[model samples]
Target: MHLSLVTSVLLTFAVFWNQIEYQQLIGSWQLTHFEGMEKIVNSSQYQNASAAEKAGMDARINYRLENTVYQFEEGDLLKFTDLENQTVVQKEAKIEIKEGNMLLIHEERGDRLAKIVEFSDDKMVLQPISKNSVSGKLIFERIKK
Candidate 1:
């Protein structure tokens, strides 16, 4: 009886751990700079810009992670709509899960861009990478409802 009880406890713990890990990625997040407490906000120019202009603006604004709407879809994919124009940016690429984090890689023309996602209790950071260098960083916070 004691052996059965111990096995049940261990199994329960394992299940709980898995559940928590999954939940960690199942909410809203914001991107902010690593140096300061400033929350990255989208600018107005993106809203009125053309597609080409919007593409250029991509490197300037931060991003928000919407994990609740799209979960477990491939490529560790999360929805990130541009805050200024409300356009979906990373919808085409496949997202991947690495270690305990999420990654999104997309190709535009010949340039390859990557987004490294990191999350905490209240915020998430989306750092954009190009040519193996960080182009910009976006910090997002959970939207309370």
Candidate 2:
């Protein structure tokens, strides 16, 4: 009986670890990397594009990925910075986590960015589920002030 109780406790901790990870996100996180993204952006077609088109793509990519930061606060308040140190993407958002530790940003908008592939106190990685396209990944690391 004692052994069974101990086992149950350990199992509980394992499940709750994801919740603890979410708590750790109540701070600033900077975009660090995106898994499989380089393959898409640096593909032959992208490289063969005209210089002007390349510049346009570069601008969109930078705004979405490079130097982008997110601040998550208590009560599900979130601030997104599409371009670092510039205009704010959104001043507020209500976030939530559904089954499988899916991070739902702007819940009211019905945006489902599912299956946070990996999460830790210092790092977070997310990959959105898509039916047609191969959705890439997003990685963020906690930014210390």
Candidate 3:
């Protein structure tokens, strides 16, 4: 009986803790910078690539850094928007925070998960949780509270 009661208490505490962390994410954030792109760009593969291929890669990365906005709304709703073109990249997406640090975005295409490397009042850093992710840590700044 004592062990069961202790487990229940811990579970409740964990859920409560996660809720607090999720609350902080309820706002509009813009992607300002990212790491690891340089590593990929400097790699031998990128160096050997054709000029057109290199330009494509650079364009994609620039688009994301300058135009991506992730709005985390109430009820776990996430809206990914492209500010440059004023279009919604993904609508009706759901987000969940696990273990108070792992962020999972459930989209129609696939789930994108990231680890919260650092978070503050206006700045957040996310490290993509993927074996194939080479973008490294993404830095976001809160645009709307």
Candidate 4:
């Protein structure tokens, strides 16, 4: 009887711990991607562009995932801010958690930006819905407080 009670307690603790770990990811994250010099040089646009133009374009593409504070008035929005351009774009929609993935819908500029998020440990991969181009995946690591 004592062995069974101990086992039950351990199981309960394990479940509770998992819930806490999942909740820790409910915060903001900064996103970045570094392309190799070879890839950049081989691209037609980059090949024709001057050094300063290439650098400026690369800077503008970096962004941040700002999920720290959500607003109900903005239709349950999640914001992604462009660090280089200092632009804050709000994604107006609802976020739903299903199974182990997060689903979000944002309708703006006549285009819907749907995303699926999968997280483990301190890392998350966000894949956005795309039509012609291949799906773009943004990998993010949780920022420490």
TM-score on alpha carbons, each prediction: 0.40, 0.67, 0.67, 0.53
For candidate 2, what is the lDDT?
A: 0.74
Candidate numbers, best TM-score first, in rank order:
2, 3, 4, 1
Off by over 4 Å in 1: 1-22, 31-77, 83-93, 100-102, 105-118
| Model 2 C-alpha lDDT per residue in residues 33-134, reported as the tens digit of each score | 775558757889778999898888777666666647889998877787654355545556778877667777774456656577777778888787767677
lDDT of 1 by residue, 1-145 (tens): 9999999999888655543244465554544444221222244555677888876544543333332123223334455434335555434334444433435444244434434455566666656556665455666666654
- Worst lDDT 10-window in candidate 4: 64-73
lDDT score for residue 108 of model 3: 81
> Against the true structure, candidate 4 has what lDDT?
0.52
Query: Candidate 1: lDDT over CA atoms?
Result: 0.48
Q: Per-residue lDDT for 45 in model 2?
A: 72
Model 3 residue 118 CA deviation (Å) reads 0.4
Query: Model 3 reaches what TM-score against the true structure?
Result: 0.67
In candidate 4, what are the lDDT values of residues 1-145, reduced to their tens digit?
A: 9999999999888655543232444666655432333455578988789889888756554333342223222334445543334756444544443433444444454444534355675666667656766555776766666
Task: Supply every candidate's count of residue pairs whose N, Cα or C atoms clash at under 3 angstroms.
Answer: 11, 0, 0, 0
Candidate 4 runs further than 4 Å off: 1-24, 34-42, 63-77, 82-86, 90-92, 99-102, 106-118
Report RMSD (Å) for each prediction in the order shown: 10.8, 4.6, 5.5, 7.7
Give the lDDT of residue 122 in candidate 1.
69
